[model samples]
Target: MEVLLSLVVGALVAAAIYLMLSRDLLRFLFGLILISNAANLSIFVSGRLISGAPPLIEKGQDFPVGEVANALPQALVLTAIVIGFGLFAFALVLTLRAYRSLGTLDTDEMRVAEPKDPS
Candidate 1:
């Protein structure tokens, strides 16, 4: 099961990397989302590989040690997810504006709009 998870995580990371290299803005955005998810999965898998464990401390238990998955990685992943969401939203808006202004999604054709000067 752990091996399967690792394989799936590796594939997702690979696909995310491939998507990130594409030239399309939308593809790039999607790549970022994929990358973020892959990272979260990686973090989750790295810590003890617990299955269906709660992250809460039990009552009257010393040190609160249990078969719980590491909460640190989960917290980190949550933070990363939030940050990634903000970045994705900002990128989406930027892409939309660029599309509206340039009338195209091609990066090659979306060069900076410069003003014409006449002497």
Candidate 2:
């Protein structure tokens, strides 16, 4: 299970890179989202895979009776998910504004600030 998850994360990162290399602003935005999700997945996989166990102790026990899944990664991923969503929303709005102003989503063409065309 862990191996499969690792492969999935790797694939996601690769796809994110490919998308990020595109010339379109929307593609870059999607790439950023994919990479963020990949990072979250990697962090989650680092916590190890355990089944049917909760990280809790009995009333008289100092530790859990059985091996339990780590909760830190879960919490971290949850937090990252929220943050990623916010970032995505902000980026999406920024992209929309840029498109409205510049009339294009191509990064190479959004060069109004450049004094001279490099071509």
Worst 10 residues of 2 by lDDT: 110-119
lDDT of each: 0.82, 0.95
Residues 1-119, candidate 1, lDDT per residue (tens digit)? 77888898898889988988887878888988988888888887777566747767678866557567677877888898999899899999999999998888777676677555566
Native-to-model Cα distance after best TM-score fit, residue 1 in candidate 2, in Å: 1.5
**Clash tally for model 1:** 0
What's model 1's TM-score?
0.79
Q: Which stretches of candidate 1 lie over 4 Å from their true place?
A: 52-62, 113-119
Best by TM-score: 2
Residue 91, model 2: Cα distance from true site in angstroms: 0.4
lDDT of 1 at 56: 73
Per-candidate total of colliding backbone pairs = 0, 0
Clashing residue pairs found in predicted model 1 = none
